[model samples]
Target chain A: MHDGILTIDLDAIVANWRQLAARVAPSVCAAVVKANAYGLGMVPVSQALWRAGCANFFVATTDEGLLLREALPQARIVVLGGVRPGREQGFVEAGLWPSLFSLDAIERWLVATAASGTSAPCVINLNSGMTRLGMSPQELQRFIESADAERLDVKIFMSHLACADEPGHPLNQQQLTQYSQLVPAVKARWPEVVLSFANSSGIFLGQEFHFDLARPGAAMYGVNPTPALPNPMRPVVSLRLPVIQYRTITEPSWVGYSATVQVQAGQRLAVVLGGYADGLLRRLSNRGEGELAGHRVPIIGRVSMDATIFDVSAIPEAQLPPIGEAWVDMLSPVLDVNLVAEHMNTIGYEVLTNLGSRYHRNYVGGAS
Target chain B: MHDGILTIDLDAIVANWRQLAARVAPSVCAAVVKANAYGLGMVPVSQALWRAGCANFFVATTDEGLLLREALPQARIVVLGGVRPGREQGFVEAGLWPSLFSLDAIERWLVATAASGTSAPCVINLNSGMTRLGMSPQELQRFIESADAERLDVKIFMSHLACADEPGHPLNQQQLTQYSQLVPAVKARWPEVVLSFANSSGIFLGQEFHFDLARPGAAMYGVNPTPALPNPMRPVVSLRLPVIQYRTITEPSWVGYSATVQVQAGQRLAVVLGGYADGLLRRLSNRGEGELAGHRVPIIGRVSMDATIFDVSAIPEAQLPPIGEAWVDMLSPVLDVNLVAEHMNTIGYEVLTNLGSRYHRNYVGGAS
Candidate 1:
């Protein structure tokens, strides 16, 4: 972040973690820093959670595990996708635990560990219902038979919930039952290994889902895991862009690409330097609203590569800040990260991770 | 891109440029490689165009120009937003030609150039109508009086059209007239400087919009510069994802986040690893369609952050590919990038640029 464009509240992140952590009471809380902490700068985000007493961390790939290790050298880092061929050594070198999803992966890890003369740190991923990236019950049993789980240094046995976000969904109960049945089997084979199943949403699915560790990602960054309940999270990321130029378009002046919008009579249009390339979703171009000195400014034209035009005439007191000044005194009330996700017809994860790298990012709290 | 993830055809890119260059006929074609060649890899995209005889390239900011210079070492790189305070020195160090917009930026560039004991490379940007960036006609006159345009090493005098995409829109004519007036003024000051105007959309506005150089961005990547005409360009990028698992869903088996989708009796569902985080709009999950073994497959559920479920029950001969294998036997219909842009409520630029680093990108075509 080189422009002082966005200020991320790390305290908000810690507070959101505390709120989610409180719900799981006695269960240990883990931070999911996968996808660059959902695109909010993972190192800083995880450091904040670590200070807030987060002991465990989960990441999707080996690269992510390496990043987390660099940040939290003492924390237990679990690689969610397990070790792939040619990558087991990287995991070992980084002191990262690989999530074993297949018999082949386990066998490969065992071979790599033997080759390196090192005890392989491992986690077992069981497929409860989401038939993706996890070992099936049959596969797990076959693995246990072929290779002794007791011999391997397994750290955690985990399963993901497909419908944990929706508490009313029946599959959550079915997945809970299926995953729980495998837990005893896993524990019997490897009694020393801890168990973790819940993600951000699953952590909210009551104590049953919170086995031993709760891995919270989005909720820790302020998305409501339980939408039905009042949101316990405060927004952690605040995006702001500098107002490049301001112009009052009398009646006929048009704005932006394809002439998607026309300035009405007596409208003051403020052109912003940030555009879709800057991660201001083009769909939100004309449909969205921003702020200028607390005055709500309507985005009035098609967003271009590096510029968006907003109508500021409505705000009588709104003075266009100089070119370098951030127009958003705070986060735009009309812009929600989730809403941008929805507007892009994508999930919040995509919206977060896809955020442009051009913005000058500032963290208010945390390890920074 | 590994496993047929996403293929970028350099041929299509060069072909698009050649076609646009042909449309501009005698006008020298300049390519807009800003925003990292509209989110396609800038180095490769610009190199291809440069090989195809494009002499000029445009970027949004000075920083972009500085980085792009490493790729096209000898190419004439133009920084469209001009020199901001604290950035002009770096611009000079990188050998960038800045499009001078404001009086302050002009003065600063001159001062920096004098201080560095170098002739400053510059371009005069006249604000014909789009008040976003560039100097006004009045400012142009003032600039000529204040600065030594002859000694400034001005390369191109240009203006941007606000509504070139809409050829019928009168603003084009107004901007064209305003810009035409400044061309003479600019010529009077520096007759040797080349003239450039017309972005991707403006090129389609006929010969009038074209000058000594035409800078086209989206058109080079296959977006329709002229929406009224049949598309003369081919898409440069294609995204493909592997089907991780295929499962038999008994009546009412839930799929994906929130269990929003329920498989009916005898339905078959294939889970895909690519999701919104991979840059596929989540709305494309259940609402979009793909082709499996030449048979249409409708997506079956809400798109998860990392997975999507597709209804492959209709494809009778469908056999689930092993995990990590590209479901190439199932080819999605050739969807237009523009339509995908529309679906994502953004232009193709965002959709392409937002593509995550996780994707393995493969480029096909000649060095040009």
Candidate 2:
């Protein structure tokens, strides 16, 4: 196996989910399994989460919702992207709830429900401050005032937090205030409507933010919810790349593409079989570090398409194993995902999601 | 489909390969189909290239070489990563050529060959300038002097270019000089040894760089080969993402996570169903632009896992299609791969290889 090994700890994922669930007790914690459960394989992550007592799941599209429905038959799978006009039957038949973002989508779902002669439970996504998705305040008000609200089976009234990651951001308070105001108005018409406003970061804000359900995606996948504070979540993935070859330069030499790094004479360099194509970002060329035994080795030069060279001169001679027999940990408990993200000038979410399919993925410690 | 549509023009790929092949005529133009053909699906891309009369294929690892061998039984598949000790049987059985980069690998292959009583052809990779992989100058000299050189079935003497993209880089000339020197030395012992050098950019460096074979990967995938000159290759990929939702904010509001972009009252935003997880880098949060009905729209705020909000205020309201019916061209003739790379502060190769699997891939116009 020349490909890197991506070991995913499902047990750690479950523990993280449980921790988040415990944080917001009495409020249901829904797992966001969109983007293939943040590129950690949706089926396995969702199964593990479901086993940890997660009853509600959120996916980006109806297609993902369908896949999740097949994986978790009893869990309530909600498509956050909502229903397309012609493709409503898939969501309806599969018992997948579409988070209707606009009045047009609401009307389309209503028509589909009427055609099927069966009303499907759905969430009404209200836009508080984030202008990306959901219905505007005017549109929401109009929907609540109209008789269309009476015809639809609305189970949840949800709104996404724009600046939830930042606890002190004014937009969070603004969104929270708008959502708090809208929930009562929604409940006035539909008293049984469940309110779900908090996300991963929002759950850390306060108990007031946690209403009926808390949706956490990144935290469960081992991404730091609180950027300013230390991460409370356990590490879930460790990437181990094999050393394809090692070379010693007796003269001054350049390494990798663009001739970026210059190596001193008699310096040992190990070429690992993992690069940008394996989701090791090109930005991590000279910045990234890998762990060999207990010592850290700095990655030298530009990251190639399928290889990255690391300066292993700091390690003792006896510690260095033969090329194929040795491996370097790109991501581990010590070299955490957050640090990798920092090195790449991005977030942990990008690091985890960009992890390519070339790795030999091993999902360890699920229900078994 | 809610997922983004990835349209791969195989005819364009063939045209690009033909162009590269034409550039290095009389010399073998092998296709580097490693990293799953730079994340464009290896099987389809290799098949298309094979149909275009590409007889030689280069892959990163033995596993990839095996897969390519299965795809094109008669084609010469060279594993650039070489054999991993005990895994030599698979390569020998599959008739895959392993490019030995080190003396350790050479010794292992010799043992595997002697045990099996089969002398499989292999390539000796020499380190001319880039010390990332292959045998160093000293190691190559020692190997040539050793008695083991007489027993090996070495077919090709290859060296990779370090700064081939930069035509005027001193390292290019240095590498060429070193490789030129090594070629004659290798041919002195083994008169039948074939010399292979020159990548996609190296083909443009001059005819001198193109020895016996030119291995091009990125240019065939529509990445700019000669950065200083106009690209001779045709565009092979176009990505179109659906508009999941659209909203007109009537108040001062934030868009996407982190409240990165503050929108003025009555600003229109379209949430497209593609984000960082879909290989759209998070660095492109507020910098990236997409085309909607020939109008360029700037992406506002942070790019989420499954969605990106595009500021579509410039686009005429009459031209805007219904929410789900509308689509934006993320990568097209106008929004080329190189342009996206610039937006993400990376190279076109990184952009192409980082392309995720969630997109509904459509391959069009192959050899009929």
Candidate 3:
């Protein structure tokens, strides 16, 4: 097979989840399985996490929630993106909980629930300081004063962190303060409502941020929750690319598309079958590095749609394998996802999610 | 329903192919269906192209070739990445043509053919300029001198352009000269061997660059074949993202993750359900622009994994639709793929291929 191999260590993922779960002990550690579990196959990841005692799962859309519900019959699946106007009945029918971000969303949910004659559980998202989602303070106040809001069966009151990755960012403290004030008002209305505030990065922002539940997404996939410090999570993914061919230029030659890299005489190059289409960003052109026989090789020239060339001159001739039968490590323990993200001028989350479906995915150490 | 809508116009694709084909009349116009037809669903694209009189198809790897073979049993499918050492038999058995790039690949193909007791048709890739693949001049000479190379059945001799996008780049002329010299030498060995050159952009470099076969990939997908001139091809894709909610912040607030953008009071923000995980690059944060009810809005702060907030203060309140039932055009006729690529400092090719699978894909105008 010429396609690259994407080996996902489910044990490492489980270990990362366990590590984060241990860090925020006594608090509910919900798994965020949105974006197909960050593009690593949601069903498999969710199944593995469910087997590891994770009862609560968060997904981006109602469709994802339905899929997760199908996989985990008894788990509490929350739709983070909430329900689209006419799609509320679908969410209700699937027994999925929608995180009502606005007063309008709450009203729509109430209508769906009243029509079904079933008081479906829901979550209220309060906009602390992040203006992206959730009900604004004024909206929250108006909803809190309304009888309709009180009539619905609210399960969890949650808010997303805006600057959780940077613990020292002033917005973190500001958001925490806003969240603290908002939760009390929410508790006054629904005294038994569970509070969930912390995300992957927020879990590391101290115990105050970690309320009743912690929704960690990237951290479980081995992305560093605390970017300023060492990662407490174990690496989960390793990508190995198939070497198409190896060539030694006897004269000065330009390599790859656009002739961006000029190679000297006797410079050896190995063209690998992995490129931007495979989630290897074009920004990684000439900047990315790969490993061959334990030796580092710098990628030369622009990354093509389906292939990239790496300068493998540094590796000893004895260490190099036969041209068409060799595989090089593009992403591994040595060159982790985070480092590759840095090379591409993005975060590990983008790198992970952008991983194409072309890879031959292999799952290791998951529940049978 | 919160997922973005990616509408692909296959008729526009057919139109583009017709335009390119008309430009190089009598030269067999082959379609490059590599990278899942540049991440626009290969099966549908190939079927449409095949019906449009496209007899030849090119793919990146053997796996892609196998898929195309399953779809088009009678079409000439060429594997550009060539056959891996022990995998040559599979390619032969599947009746797929492998572009042999090196002398070693030729040797392995001979061995595989000997073991299978059947001669498989193959193409010879000559390293005219782009050194990423194919045999070097020295290697090509050695192969031509070998008796084993004469035993194998070769169909076409091809080389890739290095700088076809740049009309004035010296490398274009240099590669053309090299390809011209190499093709004649190969023809002397095999008089019936057809010559294939010119990619999408190379097709616009005039008839001289267009050999017996012209392979166009990006042009058929609505990418500009001639970057220096107006795009002769019609747009093929349009992406529309759902607006999850609209918020009017009355207090100072941060818009998205890391608190990248600080918003003033009375600022209107609309959170759209599309982010980097949805193939929108993070580099587009605070730079990308989306259209809401015909008004362009700047994306605020950092784009989260599942959401992005757009500054909709410029848009009139009366023009805006209901919060939960509205959608903004992320990529449309107003905001094309090329412009979006500019915001991320990349090309339209990356933007098209990076499009995530979560979107509800709708194919319009093809074979009907």
Candidate 1 lDDT, tens digit per residue, B25-87?
888898888887777788888888778888788988766887889888889988876666677
Ranking by DockQ: 2, 3, 1
lDDT of 1 by residue, A1-368 (tens): 24426778899888888888888878888888876787788788888888888888888666678878887889889877566556778888889998877676787888899899998779888877765457777778776766456568888888888877678987788888988888777787888878888988898788888988888898887676776775566877778776656565545655666566566667776766677777666667667777787777777777777777787887773455655554653243256666565555555566676677777788887752
The candidates score, on chain A by TM-score, as follows 0.93, 0.98, 0.98
lDDT score at residue A284, model 1, on the 0-100 scale: 70
Question: Candidate 1: what's its TM-score on chain B?
Answer: 0.92
Residue-level lDDT for B157 in candidate 2: 88
lDDT of 3 by residue, A1-368 (tens): 44699999888888888898998999879999999999898999989988999899999987788888889999999999988888888887888999988877888888889899999589988888777788877788888888887677889999988878887888888888888888778888889899999999999989998999999999999888888898788899999998888887788988888887799988889899989999999999989999988888999999988998999999877789876557889889989888888898888999899998899999999773
Q: How does each model score on TM-score?
A: 0.86, 0.98, 0.98
Q: Residue by residue across B176-239, what tens digits does model 3's lDDT show?
A: 8888877766888888888898999999999999889999999899888788788777889999
Clashes in model 1: which pairs? Answer: A1-A360, A1-A361, A2-A360, A283-B345, B1-B360, B1-B361, B1-B362
Cα error of candidate 2 at position A111, Å: 0.6
Model 2 chain A lDDT-worst window of ten: A129-138
Q: Which candidate order results from sorting by lDDT in descending order?
A: 2, 3, 1
Q: Given the true complex, what DockQ would model 2 score? A: 0.80
Residue clash pairs of candidate 3: none
Please report how far candidate 2 places residue B354 from its true position, in Å: 1.1
What's the DockQ for every one of the candidates? 0.36, 0.80, 0.79
